[model samples]
Target: MLSVENLVVSVRRGPEIVRDVSFEIAPGEILGLVGESGSGKSMTSLALMGLLSPGIDITGGAVRLDGTDITHLQPHQRVARNCGKVAMIFQEPMTSLNPVLRIREQLEEAINVHDPRAGPERARELLDMVRIPDAGHQLNAYPHELSGGMRQRVMIAIALACRPQVLIADEPTTALDVTVQRQVLGLIRELCDSLHMGVLFITHDLGVVAQLADRVAVMYAGKLCERADVGPLFRAPLHPYTNGLLACLPDPESGNAAFETIPGAAPRPGAIPEGCPFSPRCNRAQETCRSGPVPEAHGPERQVAVCHFPVRQEAPA
Candidate 1:
């Protein structure tokens, strides 16, 4: 449903924030973009949505939605073709939803933006579709009156108010408790299944990706490190950064203790390393890792890894 090719984005007077990142999502498929903070995960999403700040520019690459190039379109033009066709649920619910507006007003605004003829009744119906009980009464409730989970749900309701074809959820469950987080995630998965919506789920949590994505893309220092199916990526991560991220996830089968973390910090923009951006923190790094451009290798189903030495799965001892 969406294809991004060699997308290079940067801010004016600043280093690139998103390097040659690329990926594709088919209808009803969820593609998870996983990385640590400052890994350029969110920046890529914003770029795709054409919502980047004033200073940022798409230095290179194209974002095609259903084979239509949308890279150079004006903001309003993008909305006309892609608004209801592609919707996004931002990371923070508290700030995403308008504090001054009532839930009904917010949702109806979305509906009207996409279909001006939609009335109050249609807005209430959307609330019910998102499983909000007493949908009619809650329409008058302001964002501040709702709990974090409810607000998140309201955001989802608004995003789905237009019945979008693709849903870009950027850390949709970051603020809620574990139980509520699970509920929200479940709702997203259920909705995707029922609506046959394509999803680009951006998050730092590997566990969430494991449970939610069909394919996974790992990014580091603004570049894509690896891309593979969820099963193969989790069982055997090809890139050093992907392995490090998996190592950091707590393994219940090994007890509840924290897993080993990758050492060192992510490089800041304009400070990325000469060769491999992850070499400083990667245990498997070799001398050559610091001296040359990493080569891209393609595996089954176009799985790609940008590394000098990709990891291979080992047989059981």
Candidate 2:
């Protein structure tokens, strides 16, 4: 399993950007981290990989892959162990992959980093594993020579070169079209099942979450507001922020004429409110929500919401 406990990230001697966030992804399971822009979802992922920018740092918390503690490791140290334990798929393949390098060269480089004994055959095998057709031909092509979807598949292939125990995908499908998005999502699920690798998928798309995630964790500003199984979280979201996010989804059955929107942009780090960072934009906010720290409330089946007045629902027997 990939476990993160009380993860805290902040700027150098500055305010926190990710506060006490914790979650886990079991082997063969996908945990979707959903939030609006600047909600610290990406920051949390960066902390796990020990890739935080110069001014930013992981102030507290633990990140474990399978059984190894990687929380305090330096960048080079993490990179050394990353191949067999943890790997990340970044947002844009164009930027993540080397534009000048042939697909084969890049894949070979990743494998050689951890296993020098591996050869050219391994690179071609990876392309096939990701279902990229004409693997042999594709391997010889440069990243720019392939389509956007193809480039993404190459990125996934590289990430899986060492068959990591845990995978962190940060908006991997954001740039793909609907058809390609579905294909990539299915590929991720298939790989997760086949490899039994825990996956932490970070994205703002709830539609994708509903389709891909086994569980969902809702984040706001810098804090995790709610977490629950995907079905329950979607059917009966506990946090108001989650409700607002779900409300924004278009419902073909309801025949709703307009889409709902969460008012106000998410607060930037260092500007978060003392109490609930979302209190300023929440429709149900009371004076208490804005004056004091919000306590986490527990519900059935391990559901958790950091709200004084989460949505009401009957407990399952």
Candidate 3:
């Protein structure tokens, strides 16, 4: 239900944070956006939600929600035009929630924003929807009173308050423990199926992507390096960055002690190289890789990699 094409977000009179990034999230599908820190994943989401902070703005391209161009629209405009159409679950629940307000007040406000006639009963139902225990009593509790997992569930409840068509969950499980993290991931999967909402699940964890996402998009230096079905992308990664990331994952079969790592760090924003940002660290990097603009190559089975020499070359069509 969401289509982002050639999206670009840049600092005012400065360098770009996200460049030429494009992806699509269809109804009832979860698209996992995986990347390292400062890779512009969050910035891209903020741009989508019209929540980009001052001094940063979407400078080019378009974001269409169900065929509507909401790219340059103000936050309020987006909400007015597509009420409850797009919602976000931020990285941290503790900060996202209000310190003073009770859970009931927060949820009720969200409900009323898109739906004025909705009452406190709606708030209670929302709590139950997120599978929170003692939904009736928890509404009276402040955010501090709830545990981390409970607070995250409440955050999910608030995001679902509007029954959004598109949900942008930016590292929603980052702060929770593994057990709680699994629960939250399962909940997201269940909700996506039941609600038939498209989810843009942005995270740095490939494990989570494997568990939850149907399709995976790998981002590096603000550009999409590879995208394919989750299984195929993991099974046979075409881009060097994708291959490196998989290599870094601990392999239980090998019983190896030392963790494999990509040799170098990612380039800082505004310091990106002219061509192929990952070329410097790529073992297969050649002189041609750094000489000019890198081009995207299409591999078999609907895979696309942004590199001159993909790990596996495209077959004859």
Candidate 4:
């Protein structure tokens, strides 16, 4: 029930950092926002939350919750108006959580702010909801005392305190071990289904997207170059950047190199050219690709990159 229309974010004294990005997150749906570093994944999430840093601002477009536009709202105002309607689970829990406070103390803070039913029991319930064992005992532990996974779980519990309609999970599994990451991903999927929470999952991990997202939005150098369902996009990616990303995934069965990286890195904001930002690195790019606006290919539920040449119908799986 959340829609971001042509949302543009820019640094006040610099160029547009996040350009014309748009998407929707329906109830019970997880829309994965994927891109390499500097592709503006985190910036887009921050823009959605009205949490842009001092120099950056939403220069264009509208972010509406259900139907009302909240793009113009200040960070504090957005929190006040859409606290329960929209909530975010930040990328790093260690930085998000208070180091000095007890786990229960932190959780109770969230409950007291968004939920009136505050107490040790309510705090315990939150911990239980996130599948943290021995919830009561862990409540007394400090952030430093908990493992990385445990701390992330605590962050999720706090985000769920308001039962938010839209949950922005910005790489919740970033630093966890693989096993813990799997558990955390599964927990997020289960919570989505059980609570019918619309989630905007931001990560550069396509493997994680394949496992968690119903739909995908591929961003390149701040521009959304493709949009499609996970199945079609995975079975056959339509954009060069999407294909590049897919091809870079390690294939255990094929005995390929452990790491297959894309040739060039994503461009820093303002360093990108006027036309398609991906042209320099795109294999199919031509002289014409740099001369005009990026071409968009739109289908029922799909959109592809701007290219003067044809793209492969089926990406290497």
Candidate 5:
């Protein structure tokens, strides 16, 4: 299992930005981290990948892959010791990939980095694994030569070239249309089943989470608001934030009425409320909730929720 226990992050000499976050993903399972912009979704993935910005650092927490703690490994140590054990597919492939290099060179770089013997041939295998059409011809194509979805396939090919036990995909489908999005999601699902790689999928779309994640964690203001199996989370979201997110999705069954909107925006790390960061916007928040750490309710389904009074029903009437 991939475990993130009591993770905390802070800016250099600054206040905490990610607070006591924790979750786990077993091999072959996809754990979705869903939250709005600046909710620390990307930060959590960055921390796991040893790619946090120079000004930010993980202050407390332990990240483990199948029982081996790697939270404190320096970047070089991660490359030397955990090369194939962990890999990340970034949010934007166009920016992540080398624009000047052909797909073959890029994939070969990732493969031969850990195993020199596994060269261009292994690169071809990776492209085939991600089901890229015309793998042989595609390898010679540059990033600009491929479509957005095709570029993303190349990105996935690189991440899998190392055969990681854990894959952190940070909104890999954010730039694609619905059709291409489904193809990428399907490819990920197929890989998980075939390779048994645990995946941490980060996204803002609850609909995507429902379609792709076995379990989902809701984040807000750098705190874990709620987590549960996707079925239960959508059926009965415990936190007001989770309910609010679900409310915001346009329901075709409802004939496109104005999408429900949360009253206040998510708070920034430096501007969080004194106690519950979401208190300023939560309708069910009370005076006590406004001044204390929200009590967490833990249960059998692996559901963990921080709420004084959670919403058990849909946010809208």
Candidate 6:
């Protein structure tokens, strides 16, 4: 339902935050964008939604929703055609929702933006769709009055108010406790299945992606390092970085000890390494890895890995 090609985004005084990243989401499919913090995941989401702050620009590439190129459309123009069609659930619900407005008012505003005639009843129904209890009673409550999970539900309600075709959730579960996180994610999956909505769910949490995504794209230092189906990725990740991430996940079979962690930190914007951005930290890095350009397409399904020495699956031990 949405496609991004060679999408590059950069800040005025910084190096590119997103570099030539590309992916597509089909209707009813959830494409999870996974990476470490500062890997440009959130920036990519904002760029796709035309929500980037001032001083950032779409320096290159195209964003097409259902075949129409929307890369250069003015912000207001894009909003008119694409805003409601592609909604977003931001990472932090508290700051995302208007603190001054009651839950009902915020939701009603969202509905009115797309369908001005939608009344209070329609707003309440949207709340019910998100499974929020006693929608009427919660309507008059301001953001502060609601718990973290409840506020998130309200955000979901608002994002779905327009019956959006695509939803871009940027770390939608980051602030909630484990129980609430599962609920929010389950609600999202249910809604997507029921509405046939496409979603680009951005997160650093591999566990979340493992549960929700059909396909996973791993990003590093502003570029896509690997993209694969969830099963293949978990079973036999082809990139060293992908393997590193998977290795970090705690294994119950390993006695619940802290798992192996990827070495080093994500590079800051202007300080990215010359070759593979992950080269400095990658255990498999060789001289060629530090000099060659990122790899292009490597498999069927257009699975791309930007590593000169993409990992091959090992034999069963």
Model 4 lDDT tens row, 108-171: 8778777775655888988999999999899999999988899999999988986788899998
Candidate 6, pairs of clashing residues: none
What is the TM-score of candidate 5? 0.95
The digit string of per-residue lDDT tens for model 2 on 128-232 reads 999999999998999889988999999999889856788899999998888998999999999999988889999999999999999999999888999999988
lDDT of each: 0.86, 0.88, 0.91, 0.84, 0.86, 0.87
What is the C-alpha lDDT profile of model 5 across 1-317, one tens digit per residue? 88999999899989788889999999999999999999999988889887888899999998887788889775468667854367888778668889999889888887877667874578878888998888999999989989888999899998887778889899999988889999999999989989999999999988899999999999998989899999888887888888888889899998977879999788888888877788899898889987856788764477778888887653456
Count the clashes in each prediction: 0, 0, 0, 0, 0, 0
TM-score of the candidate numbered 2? 0.95
Each candidate's TM vs. the true structure? 0.94, 0.95, 0.96, 0.93, 0.95, 0.94
RMSD of model 5 against the true structure: 2.3
Q: For this target, which candidate reaches the highest lDDT against the unseen true structure?
A: 3
Error of 4 at 34 (Å): 0.6
Residue by residue across 164-248, what tens digits does model 3's lDDT show? 8899999999998999999999999999999999999999999999999999999999999999999889888999899999999
Model 2 C-alpha RMSD vs. true structure (Å) is 1.9
| RMSD to truth, every model | 1.9, 1.9, 2.2, 2.3, 2.3, 1.9
Candidate 3 global CA lDDT score: 0.91
Comparing candidate 3 with candidate 4, which one achieves the higher lDDT? 3
* TM-score of candidate 3 to 2 decimals: 0.96
Clashing pairs in 4: none
lDDT of 4 at 269: 86
In model 6, the Cα lDDT at residue 171 comes to 95
lDDT of 2 at 71: 88
